[model samples]
Target: MTDLVLGPLLRHVGEHTAAIWVETADPAEVTVTAGEHQASARTFRVHGHHYALITLDGLEKGTKTPYQVESDGELVWPLEPSIYPDSVIATFDHEKPLRMAFGSCRTSVSHDSAGNKLHGVDSLRAYALRMSGVTDTDHEGDPDPGPGMRWPDFVLFLGDQVYADETSTEMQTFIEARRDVREPPWAELKDYAEYAQLYKVAWSDPVNRWLLSTVPSAMIFDDHDIRDDWNTSLAWKQEMEATTWWHGRIVSGLASYWVYQHLGNLAPEEREQDDIWQRINSHDGADEFDATDLLDEFADRADQEPESYRWSFTHDLGSQARLVVIDSRAARVLDTENRSMLDDSEMAWLDEQLRGDVDHLLIGTSLPFLLTPGLHYVEAFTEALAEGAWGQRWTDIGERMRQGIDLEHWAAFQDGFHKVSDMVLEVARGERGRAPETVTFLSGDVHHSYVSEARSPRKAARRRPRQQSRIIQAVCSPIRNQLPTGERIGARLAAYWIAGPIGRLMVKSAKVPTAPLRWKLLRGPWFDNNLATLEVLPHGLRMWWASGKVEDGVHHRPRLITVADVTIDKPTKETR
Candidate 1:
């Protein structure tokens, strides 16, 4: 029996359709059935691994049904009398506002007592336990937690779902058994096989697996998903290519990402239009079709020719809200003379997405668009200095430091930053569309979490009336990864106090222009393993960060606890 290998991960649910993805031990036709509705697909092989994405369409809006998976007529899911609840597919209601759980940067590791102490309890797992009503607490008559845990329409995983560069111990063991860990690629992932294993280690936990099965999710990629500071600059890319192992790494990373993460991001309509998906779906082979050459060539092309493909996508929450998930890493223009966080094509696409007619506009990028002013200025100064603003000596130093510390966020790409900032302001002022209640940047990556509020640009304010839409930045990171103790102090200093003045002076010395936007950190730079969720409500747009806490060292079952919460309410009629 070729049992399920990885998932039944629910993805991209609309009013009438949804996608369900799974991997099998062998090539098999997989099916998902919910009540009278069902969808099935034959497995397609990528480098000997078999996967199928069965998308169930034509479901009625706002309906809920328990779904089960089968691989070639074998009922492989639900486990009959399993401890967990049945995995259900819940279609989105057009009347409902958007509520989603989001964060980034989780490391795959053990979840026992030792693992808990080392890495903190997994926030995502804690969330799963809560939503599933399977808390390990011994309290008699176990009281119900709030309904909000299950309230999110879906979860949005910002990035770094799997770390290819900093492999876990299990991943390293797999690498060592296959070849020399002391080789050029070393313990880092080398191919699609390794990437497949990394995913198994990351998502195969019973609790996380259950969470994914029951709840739909959306995702994008960040640097560590491929490597630290991936595509940080032209020089960095050149340096990596000079190495012997990089081509294999790039091809494998991108190929595996497409299979595991990117494909699921698309809706049913988008899937039909995707070139690679069409290529595989059109196959008529009597046996399971192998897509090794197609996947490899596609991945390689995506790496070399950035404009040939795009990873950015958009989701509309009925007419209430819009989520534009931008691909920050791959679609980069990294040449120093024209260094930008996004290419021209991607920028034009985002300009269209940022229009504000809905109740809220949520821009999801892996890197924070509005970083703490201090860090923003530092990155701006670094970019200028690296481009020879202060002459060769400083330029070399700036380039080294930029790549050394991973400074290629939106702030580092000053041109793109200004352009997007202006676009956001334009939307806020009702120039592009009716101004939304809030324009929030939802992001994660820096190993810390915070909320910032952007003030209107001085020139824009003088030219126009006061903008009503609240401009804000919300960042949550490290669903498991936590910053070390020593570095926390440095992060605090950079975020809260002295670095702003020093960074500004440095920026002036480098002849860097002032940013088009100004913002102050409103809430935190908390260093915790947290999962943040936000809900669009009638009163305001509400957000809260939660972390897992294991009481009395009872690490096997950690409970979820809120770390911070905020609500950006709409202005009253007169104020507006």
Candidate 2:
């Protein structure tokens, strides 16, 4: 690897200081040169990647601080003309509520024109490259502006940041170059070496690494993080359990996820106290142990003992409120009889976290709380089929479906789904504590983007205003994945006409009770790779989902595919 990209990463303006962490490509003496101060750290291998964490203290809140890093007494990267100074902490008078860009499903691929056609510039890769000051020149001889424009304070990656199953062309090439594809385990990410290479491909790019170095980010995983249709249903789990190479696959996936994704989610305090990585970081490069073995043990433990580790994390931005990022993938229940989207411990953690004391409560899950109307009903009905709830006559059909099954998200695990839904509603109703102005569920998966409103079904019986009884469901997906043209019609047919009425009818037909809400799509399922920014104001929330318009060209900014502003009216004294 080359010691080329230098970043002032994990940067935040704290109450008294501006903090930052950095990674170096070589064991070089790294220094941060800012306005009046400099800080340094020795580049050392943590696990295997070379890194350095540096903090610039005593920064004035909200004041921009320009910075650069030196390796072995030389500036390692070009000074990007448009990079932010150091962390600009939010102050009491900072008017912008809290604005963040969020979305998921990015695949690692070359950013050259050929790869760009398939993957596009909305990718984390391009985002990183742009931030790092890499300019792409078009065939017609135009210089594309770098990533300095349109940067958000944070980018929340919802899931599938690394696809273990749907390996990109770049990832496949890396694997193919190193090993024979015909062998077991080696064929499809069978061991730790392959997993490490996968992460290196995912993060080591000049653009993305720079983006990650500067953008304060938070993330959670979905099925593609491990495999396609991961933990979709009990039968899927059993089938995988019988595979000869699955143990290694799961271990590698979870272990790599921890090192590359989950560990990066921590804040300064948490990062300091983390036991495993701390120890790993302390070890010098000469340590003889193969990290893959330890990684397998860690992955196995994380899967076998979900309670022993925490994949979910919460971020609180002063009184603006809290963001509860839940790990719906790793911490799942795959039992046939008592299935749950989140395991018992994870649910309890979520329940505790949702007992909010923030102005707004944001729940971040990789899977949407509400599925597309058609798929939603299908998942629910399928679970019923498995249990013979639709009558024993459908058992054979259910068995066959279960054998080839993979309908995921909330509806797949009715038990956990119902439990979580009840808790969220209770929180929304102020039963849990001071009800937040809005309970925003942010998610991405299913390769589409949408915004929905959940309205209380009690609207007919009780005359509460619409604002008081509504919760926002926002989804921005595949920040890169485009729906195959062939499948678009089927996905729409399943999501709209067939999925909608059939889903509603099935609920009534099954006589199953629902929450005080019915949902409707307020915005999209538009088949574009997208990125969305959500801004919360004292009065309401303003959200805009943007996707790159190829026709718009580099000169034209990303077009706003959708925009929504929701304001929650406070309950009057008389209503209370």
Candidate 3:
């Protein structure tokens, strides 16, 4: 019997359909059964590894059913009388409240006391223990689930699910044993095999594995998923392109990402639209579809021409909300003369998706749109300087500094930033139909977490009776990783003091136009390893951050602790 290598990860749960993704040691027929209904798919081969994404249809809306996975007609998941709870597939309900858990920058590490001490506790693992009905006898501070509160409807893994650039100790050991550690690219991943191994390490923890099986999840990638400061600018790209191993690394990264992360993000219809999916579906031979060459060509083309493919996706949650997960990394236009966070087609797509009429409008980007006012201005300042705002003499130095300091964000691309901000403002003001209750930008990339709000001072002075939607920036990060003490303190000070005044002055000196809206930090710069949950309520939006805390001298079993809670009002004429 071949053991499963990766997942039974539940993905893309719609009203009547769900997709489960899995990886196995060899080519096998994978099946998913929920009650009397079942769906099966043949594993597709990529670089000799096997994967399948099984889509189950004809499900009742809002129904939660226990499910099992079988490979080669043998029950491989949910072993008989399992200690963990049954894995479930929960369909969407239009009338039900929407709640989603989100965070970024999780590392794959051990779950013992020493591992916890080094990397901080894993919040997702703690939540898994709670969901599985494990008694927290060792943890005194674990929050009891309130009456009738179930697990979040789904989870939005914002970005950096795996750290490809920053290899773990174990990964480094494996690389050194297999090849020369002194080679180009060093300890970083070089090909598909390494990436597959990295993912196995990340998802193999028992508690987290079970959590993934039961909960529907959606994900997008950030810089670390490829490399640190990936595509920061034309110069960075050129430098990487010159390396002997970078081409292989990037091609492998994108190809593996498509199979592991991006495929499950699509509905069956969407999958049918994908070229790779079509190739897999069209294959008729008994053996799996070996897609190594096809995937390599596709990845190379995508890298050479960023506009050739679209990685962004949109999901409407049955009139309650619209989720637009933007591809901030792969779709970048890094030409220094025409630097844009997104290419023209990607920008147009985002513009169309950021509309109104829903209760919530969610814009999920890996990078924060509303950075601390100070940091926002600093990034803008660097962008202007990079563009020779001060003088041509400093242009090259400014560009170097920009890439070195990792200052490329939404604010850095002023044109793109202004365009999206204008669209957001219009949506908030009901220019594109009924304004949503909130226009929230959900982001993670920076290791810190915070909440901020944007307001147009002109609207406040006019005293308009029409209800204007609130504009919010909600950030959650580092589900496992924690910043070093010195870096943390420096970041806090910069956000609080230096970035604000100095950054603003720099922008003014550069003669850049003022932003359409003013924003300020509302909640935090917490450095804890946390995951946040946002719930759409009848009145407004409620969000809280949770962290894993060691209790009663049992560090292995960390308890979930609430870090902060925030409520945004759903503005109405009566309330105004």
| Candidate achieving the largest TM-score | 1
lDDT of 2 by residue, 92-133 (tens): 223346777799888776655555576665544434433344
Candidate closer to the true structure by lDDT (higher is better), 1 or 2: 1
CA lDDT, every prediction?
Answer: 0.87, 0.66, 0.86
Candidate 3 stretches with Cα past 4 Å from truth are 137-149, 457-467, 572-576
Q: Count the backbone clashes (under 3 Å) in each candidate.
A: 0, 8, 0
Candidate 3 per-residue lDDT, tens place, 1-576, comes to 556898899989998999999999999999899998899889898998999899999999999999989998998998666678889999999789888899899998788887887788998888777677663432222233632247888899888898888998888987888889798788999889999999999998887989999899999999989998888878789989999999998999999989999988888899999988899888889888899999999999998998998889987796889899999888988876888899999999888888898989998999999888878888888888878888899788888878888898888888888888888878888888888989999998888999988877665426633438888999998899988888899989887788888887888888877887788888998999988889888899988888888888777567777888888878766432
Sort by lDDT, best first.
1, 3, 2
Cα misplacement distance, residue 135 of candidate 2 (Å): 9.0
List pairs with backbone clashes in candidate 1. none
Cα lDDT of model 1 by residue, 1-576, tens digit: 479999889988998898999999998988899999998899999999999999998898987799999988999987667778888888999697677899999988888886776677899998887777787443221223453334468999999999999987889999899999888899998889999999999999997999999888999999988999999888899999999999999999999999999999998889999999999898878789898999999999999998889999988787788899999999999987788888999999898888978888899999999888888889998899889998888888999989987888999999899999989988888888898888899999998999988867678678776777888899999899887788888878876687688887988898888887778877988889998888888976888888888877767678888888888888554433
Residue 553 deviation, candidate 1, in Å? 2.4
Q: So what's the TM-score on candidate 2?
A: 0.83
**Model 2 spans > 4 angstroms off:** 1-48, 51-58, 70-96, 120-150, 185-187, 204-207, 281-294, 390-396, 399-405, 459-469, 505-516, 551-576
- TM-score to native of every candidate shown: 0.97, 0.83, 0.96
